[model samples]
Target: MFWLLFTLFMVACFSAGATGGLFPPGAWYRGLNKPVWTPPDWVFPVTWITLYICMSVAGARVALAEGNGIAMAFWSIQIALNALWTPVFFGLQKIRLGLAVIGALWVAVLLGMIALWEVDTLAGMLFAPYLLWVTIAAALNASVWKLNPEQAA
Candidate 1:
């Protein structure tokens, strides 16, 4: 049951991550005047991979607990929002929309974290790093939007 639940959650994370492959940040992103705090290019994949593992483990733990209905729902919402941000931002070249999407993602992650905590402390703990990453991502998205008004959509 643990493996099965882990597989399902991992698949959900992987599906959301596939958007990155579909709409990669190419020359446009590279050319942007990013803030000094922007992370190096290599940081994204590594951070996401680690977050995915934590997210999947969190979900798996929650799935095993009783009365995890709300937590699971929040989990689904966060993953869906995660899948949307890439396409809207990179594919559509809409930095403003990206900010909105990421903002919602941040909220969903927060709610998911809280709800997961109620069900399983370990599951909630796993989301702490994910929330931190999303905080950074949201700041990055907002910074990019502010820095590149001409590119706003």
Candidate 2:
């Protein structure tokens, strides 16, 4: 049951992550003036893979536990927001909207972490890296928006 739930959660994470393929960061993103801190292209997929595994473990732990309504809901929220950002930013080419979405994602991750921690310590521990990644992502998104004010519409 735990493995099944973990697989399900990983599927959800991958589903959300699929947006990257759907909307690859092509010429537009390449042309943008990114901060020096921007990670090399290779880092993204690797980072996401690690984060997803941790997230799946966290979610699986929470799901199998009884009375996990709030944690589950937060988990759901973070995933939804995660799925939304790529389409809005890379698909629609809305930098400002991406910032908003990523901002919300950060909050959802934080709240989700806290909520998950209340239920299980290991689950919360698993989520910690996700929050940190989102923080970095949010900063990156913000920096992009700042550097490319012309693209904010």
Candidate 3:
């Protein structure tokens, strides 16, 4: 059961990380007017991988704890919101919608973190980076929306 659970956790993290590819090529990203402090493109994949792993570990911890069904449900919702952002922004090229989704994702992640905290502090801590990353992503998404108002929708 432990191995099965671990496998499921890994699959969730991997799938979420890889969802970036659902977007158009990085070329489209390059064309955007990014913030001055935007990290180099290569940094994104590595950061997201680490963040996703942390998120998965946190989620798995909550799942392993007693009476975590509600926590798990909220966590699942946050993950789904996370997964949808990349496609909405890059795939569909809907920056405004994506920004809105990302904002909601931030709130959902916070709710998930709170729920996980009830089960395990370490689980909540694991989501810290995830929360921070999404906060930054939200800002970036908003910046994109601002920079290209015409393409926002």
Best prediction by TM-score: 2
Candidate 3 local lDDT, 78-130, one digit each (tens): 87888888888888877888988999999999998889988999898888888
Question: Best-fitting candidate, measured by lDDT?
Answer: 2
| Each prediction's whole-model lDDT (CA) | 0.95, 0.95, 0.83
Model 1 regions more than 4 Å off: none
Clashing pairs in model 2, backbone N/Cα/C closer than 3 A: none
Cand. 2 TM to true fold: 0.98
Model 2 misplaced regions, further than 4 Å = none
User: Candidate 2 — what's its lDDT?
Assistant: 0.95
Residues 81-149, candidate 1, lDDT per residue (tens digit)? Answer: 999999998899889989999999999999999999999999999999999999999999999988888
lDDT of 2 by residue, 48-85 (tens): 99999999999999999988999999999999999999
**Ten contiguous residues minimizing lDDT sum, candidate 3:** 17-26
Candidate 1 weakest lDDT stretch, 10 residues? 144-153
Off by over 4 Å in 3: none
User: How high is each candidate's TM-score?
Assistant: 0.98, 0.98, 0.93
